[model samples]
Target: SATLRIELSRPSSSEFTFDERVNRSHCSVSVTNMSQQSLAALVIAYSILKRRRKSEQKRSCWVKPWIMQQSEFSACSMLAKELRIEDPLQFRNFVRMSSQQLQLMVELLGPIIGKKDTKFRTAISVHDRVMVTLRFLASGDSYNSLQYLFRIPTCTIGSKGTIVQKYEVFPDTREEWQRHAEAFNVQWNFPHCLGALDGKHIVIQAPANGGSHYFNYKGTHSIVLLGVANANYQFTYIDVRCNGRVSDGGVFQNCSLYDLLENGSASLPDHEPLPGRNMPVPHFFVADDAFAIRSYILKPYPFRDQPAPNRIFNYKLSRARRIVENAFGIMANKFRVLRKPINLSADITANIVLAVCALHNFLLSTRDSRENYLTPGVADSEHPETHEIIPGNWREDSTSGNSFFSLERGKRDNYTTSQRDVREEFKEYFMTPSGEVAWQYRHIV
Candidate 1:
């Protein structure tokens, strides 16, 4: 009986003081002195009038008179260079893309997000939606600011913009991943390094009475974005939907990719002999010590050992795994939304992250990126350890990661013999003359 009783809490204080605000009239309606049919008709007509009045009031609140005055400086006429954006620096500062990049995005997103008008409501033009969404991504401006600046309905700009963002962020081809592995082999001389793996926390405002379901150790609420990126700074595979409290390893264990890796369904590369060696090592993703050693995954040795082999191994692995860090930096710097906490639901935030990942890959593919526009939080030259990992953006996650995949194995040895075998073999190889890089020794020793 006590549990069944409802409890009401005091409302939180608001920025606008309620003392001088308009008070709503509390009254009842009555109709009399008419036949039953006539009275019912009169009531229905009054109801319709009330509904219309409420709708008009809501419309007036969002749609301002200033929009009409600013029609001359609309998105296309002012932003697209119709009025001529004389300063290239100014253009990049506002929209976060060059004129050429904007045109390319318009072409790419047009077919996917375009729609037709129905009898009920007019359809928004694809141009307006694309440009505004890009502007939001680049500048991290509030939805209200975008609505007023672009002179479009806030609801349309936000809703349709999210629709464009829902497209899957995974690569169109598996070849893209293979290309990344090849690049690591040729450029970094880190053979069999298929990709760099890592996880980032996408911060969001905690839901009411959320407790700790969204809380992370960083004292913030977030959803984990676990991604595998290649040497070209393109995301090859990503798991966008996971609880924030999940660790880098916890997210990895829960995803279907882990099962694929376990069952050999991932179609990984063959075991080719090490250069000038008789033994063959299978292709694998390089992650940090946050991840456990696995047959198809590698990590640096713990800080305890003082062996030269371990030092060299850590150096080589660090060089390879650092790619994912740089990739995340480039993405957050370019798409400012990731730089700050997203004041949206976890589901919507996931979509925004995925869409930006897809867009980042698209941009990386189309251009050389000699002059990428990067902000401070996420820059190309940023070192992962020195940076705060997107500070002032972590949210509180209440969910515990106890039920995540790794726990299913039970608490026996925490690791299997095969896991140890994999790490040992890789360690020995990096110490060998064929696998050793000259700069590695200077840094490690």
Candidate 2:
């Protein structure tokens, strides 16, 4: 073998050695022989190649806009499109600000905005984004789904954390909601009407803690209550915190509206008729039979002999009242979240419901114009005009009575039936053949 020399270098006090040898070029290299020098060269080359590959991988981490996949950009674009709101600040410039209306609302909701120092904060934290987030929640889109539509960061918009705290700080009380009713009436061509009241089921997830409390006879977990919508289909009142077990009538009885009417706490401003009605006006609202009929709460007349006129009035009222139903339908349809089972806490769920109603009103108000479903047209003489009214003379049996009737008796004193009689009459009216009623009114104009 050729003469061989090995030099061991250990900088620290250790038995392990790193060998070094003098190469043909007189350069010091770690090796055992010529073959070892060849191996060392290959190891250095491999190390350099590995380092370059890692650098390339790091560069590839950031995708270029052009080379970026469509799926990635689509997610962001779709969200931006949905959340895009017409410049409200720009809208403020052209639309005259109604100071009186704002003042009225402020007064009604004032108590809820109790003395909280944090209300005046200038920073735009997640708390400050409540209104926008409420709009998203009301719309019922996933957080990622809404990310591109609204300017709000996706991170802040959907989190349950403090999302509703702002609303608690700026609650819209019953009175404040009612103030919008007049504006809605004027816009929708309804006269002397505050709002249309009706009930709906807000389905919720069966609570882990309160399963029996939310269970309803309908075989689902739901909170049943009423909502009052103005002529333009804006919510003036949303009474949703009731237990799922309560009846519509029971819920209405305990509602703030009932309290206001019963206690005379609700002040009716002297009805000044618009230029058309020469006399002082009266304020009134449309309600279904679930509520007690009052001067303010107009109900359909019970069935009577030749109940045509009462039927006509009921038909008109129904035509007007359909707005609330349509409003609820649109809300549930657009914000698919409302259609699905809500799994949030009761308080947050209530706020979410109200916020959705408010957003519905806002969108309706801001649209180019609302389509009027009820065009002024006369009923065909050949086609007998059908009217469903509360019936008279069926007052003796109140309980277990027919639900349908003609309310021909205009006077309030005439509405008398024992609770039993009322129920019996309701059953009879409910069982009455629609064909028979149509045949009876077939000739009446």
lDDT of 1 by residue, 17-69 (tens): 33322123122444445566766666676676557545534333433565644
Task: Per model, state how many residue pairs clash.
Answer: 17, 50
Candidate 1: residue 294 lDDT (0-100): 78
lDDT of 2: 0.47
lDDT of 2 by residue, 1-445 (tens): 2223333322443533322111111222344445666776656766665564445342333433432332334322343233334443322211111223223334544444323435332222222243345445544556665544443445545443432112221114545434554564554333456778787767677777886786665656666547777665566666777766665456677678777867766665444543332334445677666566665665666654535544544544555576676556555644445756666666666767765665455445544322211111211112235443322221232321111111111223344444333323322332244212333333335
RMSD of 1: 10.7
Provide the TM-score for each candidate, comma-separated: 0.74, 0.49
Model 1 accuracy (lDDT, Cα): 0.66
Given candidate 2, what's the lDDT at residue 323?
Answer: 65
Per-residue error at 19 for model 2, in Å?
34
